[model samples]
Target: MANRRASERRPSDRRASGLSSRRPSIDPWRLVPMDKTVHIGGSDDFNVLFIGAGNIMFGSDEGPWNHSFRFEHKLGRRLKVVALIDPAIERATAVLQKKCDSFVVSAYQDTRVFKTLEDFVKNMAPKDRPRAVIVGSPPMFRGSLAPGRDIEMQILKFFPGVAMFIEKPIATGPKSEIQDAFTIAKTIQDSKTICSVGYMLRYLKATQMMKHIIDENNLTVMATIARYACAYESIAKPDWWDKSKSAGPIVEQGTHFCDLSRYFGGEVDMSTVNAHSLEWDENAGALSKMAVDESKIAPENRIPRVTSATWKYDSGAVGSFTHVVSLQGTNYSCELEVYADGYMLKLVDPYVQPTLYIRKPGDDNEQMVRFPDDDPFFSEVSNLIDIIEDIEEDPEAAQILSSYEDAVRTYELTWAIREASERSREAAKLKAAAAA
Candidate 1:
């Protein structure tokens, strides 16, 4: 990373973590902090400094930087981020190299940000140190220490002063590896070194809005479908997306869907799934285009071009999600169609400003509801603040969304999808081999 060139580029003396204080320059669709209501624990109001780190595997360019910058630039007064990190610094000769700069964000992690996590903590001033240290990396990137030994030791060393913001599926390794990750995180019981996973999708405004509609109307999410399509070239990668390192598509890609399904449907049990390899898959011959995309993918990391499964939620809500990688017009695509008591809501394209269609029973068709766009960055930042402020007796269960353990459970559910897909593929391969 390049050194701070201009004096203006220097890190702000006082870093603010809580979004409640930030002054957003951008004219957001909906003015947040409009409530002027700040949620906190028993502790008094405090200024928060945030430090974030990452190890991006693929799409090294994407992570918490620019989005965060937008949060800071738009709301600089409330929450200012000090540093951003990842192995990307090794390539960039510049001091501040983030995934993108369009956000008008600044303060990328310089080279030698921290050789080890311990040293970073020690450098913090007695009071100037970060109130919360966001462990804000993608699922399978940028941790110096391996899971059990080094990772735990390093985190324990930092637990005293700083809180951590971990992204979802807490650890990427197998059962033993994940367990080790949990044990280490457990060491920091009541300290502010609170551990959090980034399950941002759960924070979507429409989701919150719909939950009310469902509850008030006594709606049952009868059956739902979640379709996610990304650039074909993007999904087929060697690192975290690869099945071996992060437990393949189920744990990697499918986990999000599983979590969403569980959110809408309650508990889910995978009833059936049919997965065949793009190369050897019987369906491959039928869908040449999809097969070509799958052909470029590694068997270990190859998410099925098509995966349809049935899930029974705890309340008898049946849900099914279909995930595929195919030619789609949008840069990225997601379609969530949920059915309930007397109406349905279709949420499309969550990353961008989300769009929703609300259809009440007996209506001629779906009615589009103008989305009251909410600033998600602040939502996430504010969420971290709450976690830091609430490190009391029982932390995990108290959180609004799923915590580390809940995220792990979601990962396990997705693991079922991955396993089912793999089995389907294997069965197809064996039959083909026998016939040949």
Candidate 2:
């Protein structure tokens, strides 16, 4: 039924893109089948060409930034990584050379993918041909330092032969830019070139737990609060994380909250929003040496060390988001609180060993705690690889993952919040002038 709904709603242009290749028999229940010596799903297996080599999109500092690497690691020789990045970073380039079986360092922001493909296709090398390209760039950036049109053009060009394992908060811009990215992503949705976004939190252990809870209890989402914190300081952010380049804090950082909001409450159209900031950070940076505290967080993402916002979803659910560099909070933390029928589910610290505290009549004193973990990041990456495997086997299974279109919804939401915040500031200035 989910697949049918997706197929019925997809555009005619999108339906025409993927391949209906000869199948080699695999369990349809399992989306993408990876390499496992132990008997399980099916005997069939395949490879994929991944194009992202960024931090959150793939994995973290340890390498294999996100699930794509896990996919490759799990499938062994069957899964291939194709790396792409702003600069040919040693890690990405080295991984491509040694780790990923076949990789490309081409810039999706500058190079024309379609034109290059035409030339590459004309080449006489037998081994040069790739199975399918997975676009991991475009999204998963802190800013828009690069060009969007170029990226969109590249994705559109490669739509026919590529399956995308994109990141969440699909775009980083205002309404216009977000809309443009949406149109471009929409232009390429075919069966073979499956579209999937990195809303990895959707696969969280707590989230999975909540899915059952919500269904079993028949809870209508009344109030949902998804909070994520990046209290670290950085020396320099990626060029894209720069607000001027990326459109500001909301689009870049606040997007996780947006994605999580959508996950918990379904398609949310922000009904009301209020956003503000505590300090003009660059001023604080220049004016005070005291700003240099022990908070030696990642520098690049220092656009807003402290930020907060609130909104109401179309599903009649209210929510709030707070991002602060407070020394009090943990290094990286996320929590979601859902209120239904006076019973509350507070899920805290995800992408790790998650802890769930149920608030009800017989609850255990209603306390807040953290989720401990060992290699939690690996699980997120593994899930994404599973999605990628599904796309490779049967194009139909590919639709199960988050789509760029869905991601754009949150991007637009952030854009609106930023604009609203700015407008409120302007209104305050006008009122002050009038009194003066």
Candidate 3:
């Protein structure tokens, strides 16, 4: 996780510290273009590795963001992809050969594809080991490389303090699974690993600008509200509907807002949160003794289609989060709003076509700010490269937002909300049985 302010710096000192006055000088109409060519680098360039070879890496961008594609567009030949590890060696090789083109393969030649991470790490010389790693594997496979060891722990075993960039929804559902993630998070903190999670939205220029405004104005945030409602018709996989594999929409898709809430509102108290869920039913649309089959889904992933939850942050700020995946067609919405002293901010669609809206408190009029070349996915890779360069210069030069330890708390908040809904459903079932 990230600590934005030092302990010695009081909240009241923020406005006077001059840090808030340094606002981002970004033009709304400026179009930032991604470079098509990779900059050539010498043999002593930074070496990196990729742990997964699926859609997030090789597939086409569904909307406007794809991790591997963005990295290639930005970093190019400046870095070397020393190895790519996946269970299916053929798939990994195909992804590289087909998706990467000849130029990329030529720029990074020592890319030895391996069937497993164990094989790659064992075979490579200590000097040849990667200085950084990108983990794009699915949530269920997160902690499964070994029997009980989590992905972070396993990686730390071989390479302590390695710069790691892990994908989000840090872990799958179930309280025990969350606890496992929590343990690993603590371990990561203890080891002081240079790590960052794939909460790429936080890397958006628009988000940074909003944070700047909040700090500059010394606004006392009252509440942060977030909503994510999307149509599932375009989703290609059935397991996405099956709660077991995908962790439903909340953990799978809507986690961005949950993390944003913590970003603006500060740390949360699990005991101060409560949630309620709604599902479709036949008779009077009333909840039944068993309206849904919990067995059909994994215990960790049995999230409802619609959920509303509220929590109180340690800073005395109140927050709310809502998620829905029942819409049809191509309509979808994902955004977060902050109600602070004198001004309110609305950050819209950080994944693609990000924009920010600022309004005077109690006023209806709002001003829209947009960026043509705001590539958050690319920005995230750029940050990683910066960390790599920092480490190359000095091992302690790396500082990042959205680190793995920070992301685990977001995962915990989602799990707590799901658990609260589960408890409510069970109580309804008991009441129904008593009436019968």
CA displacement after TM-score superposition, residue 368 of candidate 3 (Å)? 1.1
> Which structure is stronger by lDDT: 2 or 3?
3
lDDT of each: 0.52, 0.52, 0.70
> What global local distance difference test value does model 2 have?
0.52
Give candidate 1 regions above 4 Å deviation. Answer: 1-67, 70-112, 122-125, 141-153, 175-195, 233-241, 270-303, 328-330, 362-364, 386-400, 431-436
Cα displacement (Å) at residue 6, model 2: 34
Give the clash total for candidate 2: 23
- Model 3: pairs clashing at backbone N, Cα or C within 3 Å: 1-406, 173-300, 174-300
TM-score of each: 0.69, 0.70, 0.83
**Residue 413 error for model 2, in Å?**
1.3
Choose 1 or 3, whichever is better by TM-score: 3
Worst 10 residues of 2 by lDDT: 18-27
lDDT of 1 by residue, 6-43 (tens): 45452231111112211112122222431343434343
Write candidate 3's Cα lDDT for 1-436 as tens digits. 1565566666565334433222222222221345533432344656678888887766654565466666665556656688888888788888777645666664346678887678887898865677788888777777433453356777898888788888887877555777677677778888987778888777677877787677657766778999988765566565775666666666777788898888877778899888877754324323223324545655454446688889998767799998875666665778899887678899887666788999985788998998656776666676576666653454322236686767888888877877777688779889999999
Query: Which residue segments of model 2 deviate by more than 4 Å?
Result: 1-45, 56-64, 81-92, 97-132, 138-156, 159-161, 189-192, 238-241, 281-305, 328-330, 361-401
